[model samples]
Target chain A: MDLVERIRSGNKRTLSKLITEVEYDTETGREALRELYKYTGNAHVVGITGSPGVGKSTLVARIVKELRKREISVGVVAVDPSSPFTGGAILGDRIRMQELACDPEVFIRSVSSSAGTVGRTTKNIIRVLDAAGKDVIVIETIGAGQVDLDVLNVADTKVIVLMPESGDEIQMIKAGLLEIGDVYVINKADLENAARTKSQLSLAIKERDGWIPEIVMTIATSGEGVEKLVDAIFAHKKHLEDSSNLRKGRLEAVKSEVVEILVEKLKMRFYEKFSNARYSDIFEQVLDKELDPFTAAELIEKEEGL
Target chain B: MKKGKNIRVLIAKPGLDGHDRGAKVLARACRDAGMEVIYTGIRQSPEQIVETALQEDVDVIGLSILSGAHMSIIPRILELLNESGIGDIPVIVGGIIPPDDVEELKRRGVKAIFGPGSSVNEIVEFIKSIT
Candidate 1:
């Protein structure tokens, strides 16, 4: 009857409303998140990250189909970058995943990477989906660049999707994607030189936690080799569980989440405190060369006990 | 405790209409207006549209149909939205539609209809007002 009850009962509208509340970071949303926390940690959160045009969305769609075939309920959180100037975005990932959109068991939410707080919001969204009882929640990151490794902390199974002939072996290693992936998905493997890419990836990927990352070749368009990718995901999940590494990974995730929250709160507090007329004296001092910026910052911190 | 929320709108082209120039223009306008626009490219079924609206939890739905199938396609989209329990989210159509059918579509619960030559600013302002 209540919000949590309705969400648990799989009321799509209520679930959607809750997600909106969460996105807005409202008081009710925070309350619901706290309430939902007890029911979280059930879904296997999968992060699908790759460069633009690497078929991350299509691969996610295919992966969800494969998951649904096994009667697993899915939640997809597709992230797209917001326009930095206008604070808007065109979340077009659903164009590829429309077939599964109508599925009663699958829920897809597009997230705009707004305000640089995408990592935190995504964590909460996954919590909502997990509490709602989705068996697997896939998070497709924004067309990522090298060093955009935020997905590393949010996902339990990190799936780095790449394409054949995308780059040479050294270029792939320089991208640092080889380090974070639990499973490597070379989507569009039907293209030329896939074998070379696979071998190249195999050489660069080092064994971590006694579980070597699996490279699964996939042509996500035709759903070729997706089942193997799914199998690889599950195998990695099993490896984590049997090795008791899942608990360890969750500990790291929680630690990062807490730190992220703290950093955001501190940033807001700092802005609220310093962005005022009262701080003009300090700014003037720094600008007039009567005080250095670092000393001025320390003075403010000491005076405000910040 | 935050109150500000991003307006999320789904702009889609339904039926056999491959002409998406208008739709793309509208989507760009909405985005520039600071609304997150989910643009599902041309030729989407009513089911796909409604399903996307529900999944994305969009504040509004804008249909761009140039195929003159508003009578059939729009109603089906509304019906599917109702069936999906998200009929409350407003649906607006923008494309080639006769003036006579505009009132008819409105009578059938379409929030608004924008025919050809409709200014992008007008449509954007209308969406901003409604959402």
Candidate 2:
């Protein structure tokens, strides 16, 4: 059967297998994506990111619950960092976002960034999940300062989750996080200085160059102000729909993702085709000043031509 | 796509949840199915899961959790995985959980759930039936 029909039919195994092929970037993988790409563009992309201890996970759980209550189909991509030494990443998302795992409408996946940067990992997976009939796809990025920009590249609405106890609001501007937020969430709002943090964020948002981003205060634990937060996001999504410019921004983001994916696939194909002991020996000879990269490429091409 | 050798399973723990005994058990089950298993240490963020899965290019990401924080962490991991671009990783959940919450998890995005006292053989067979 054709790939598009299977995807539209909601065959879980077929969806799973197609994603695997694309993950490997094989010949069929490209074909599968080409076939599946037309079926995309349906799911709303939501980005959830913050510092290490800001309770971002808890907030995500709340968001998922809220979305599910509306009977909206959801897809989630939980991004985790990797071990530098072993090149391994520990993936554990189900423990926290357990409520929706068994739901027929939701498709949750965990990705380890231990293999590559957020720039590389975020692009293709969005397509994979989007094609799987999700009404919404949530992207939870590794919140380490500026690398957070990677999330902005993919999310239709970027929600920057934050805390007051984390530090002065000026630090976020310094880190450049202030400019990227469509929604500024001051989570842990039940804390002692939660209100103060909200004002601080308000001040920071006021100073921003573009439209004044909306800031919502929430205690993610007790579910305080979560509805407003959700409403704020929906409002912003509607605003995007109303404004042609925001839609343009979304298209630009998709175009950029395509470039990134192509570059990554090209690099991977080259390494997979030429990265071996034989290629290493050629490199070693080049290291001795016997041959340059240009000469090595020539020789490798010549060998392949034979 | 074979009975075993073609698949590699990664059972990971994202976030600050340190309970890994259940994760270890699932890892063992995947291994027993003749699939290669990669286990990461505890307290993994969602980004780590996406990067590792892409690098290793595994078939499954089995998350083990005992902490009652499943709501937040699972969605976080799912969002990031979608962002990273590899989707063949059919995620399965195993650990401490209540009954009603199971349906909610399915609605949010988990492909399968392995509760306490579930047979390892049941897991193996379920996996076989999927891919």
Candidate 3:
């Protein structure tokens, strides 16, 4: 059988293979997704994002365990940063989630954000998991860059995880994280100043028009206060379902996906049409101050009929 | 084989082994060689390794087992890879392996064996050649 059939039949290997194809952005992968798109739109996409060393992975493991207790199948896409110099990544999230390795109901995959546009490859991987019949699909991004916030577009429920002593209140606000979070989690709450951090976060977060973002304190190591966080997630899910918010979120996600694909295709077409020699000539003119970049770009667009 | 494409490699430590210094070093070596490396941490099961390899669509599977469980672990991974129809993906073994078991592992479809003192350059070159 083809990859789509194998994935629909619950073949974890084929599911993984198809995800790899999508991650690499191959034609075969695109064709496979085209065939498997019909099986999607069933899984609840959750985005768990936080800064480095904030125990996002540990929290994810706890959430997966709690989700498994409910007999809900889960698929995790742990995104790790790739070295700009080497294009390599050490995907260590699986270390914290090793307990789920043997659990057939849980499928965990690690992806490198260096593959392409940030969160673009991850969104595609989530689609594969969704097509594979997962009840809940969680995407854990490398919460290091501003680009990581792009995950908000793909996840229906955006869970922004923070530690008590993260000490980046101003940085979080600047990163636009305060605007994207649907649920705020103060993880590693057992640390010092946990309450202070929680209060500060609450003060920083402005109330939404309809949904007030719930802040849950969690000690992921010992699984303390995790159930409440899960409850908050379920509550958000229920809220989305109760309102037309779920449909609206889906429409927004589709729009983002379409725009991303279009931009990528346009970039490829632009590069293909303009050779390096032409680019070098343009750069030379810019370097010699013969033509400004804006004028050069306009000239190229007019000449190429782009 | 596009220009400047990364050759993704999954450097995994399967079985009940906790010695990961060698795995981490090798993972870095592969990374420094300009290949995308996914290190699976330590004490991973064969099922997890195979699943990760399939998911990563890695060009190679590097097993770092110092627990002397290579006899039991490597074969299980090979079997799983074949069962999953990804047997064509080469499997390379590293770490402390007795001289007697090296030939046996090779016969069992291990692409290459790197014992103690093996240079990282050699391993990276071998992977590049095969891939």
Best by lDDT: 1
Shift of residue B55 alpha carbon in model 3, Å: 3.5
TM-score (all chains, Cα) for each model: 0.94, 0.65, 0.91
Candidate with the greatest DockQ versus the true structure = 1
Chain A vs. native, model 2, TM-score: 0.81
Residue lDDT tens for model 3, A164-185: 8787567555647877788999
Which has the higher lDDT value, candidate number 1 or candidate number 3? Answer: 1
**Model 1's DockQ?**
0.76
Q: Which 10 residues in a row give candidate 2 chain A its minimum summed lDDT?
A: A82-91
What does DockQ come to for candidate 3? Answer: 0.53
What is the TM-score (0 to 1) of candidate 2?
A: 0.65
Two-chain DockQ for each candidate model? 0.76, 0.07, 0.53
Q: Better model by TM-score, 1 or 2?
A: 1
Output the lDDT of residue A128, model 1: 92
C-alpha RMSD in Å of predicted model 1 compared with the true structure: 2.1
TM-score of chain A of each: 0.94, 0.81, 0.93
lDDT of 1 at B46: 89
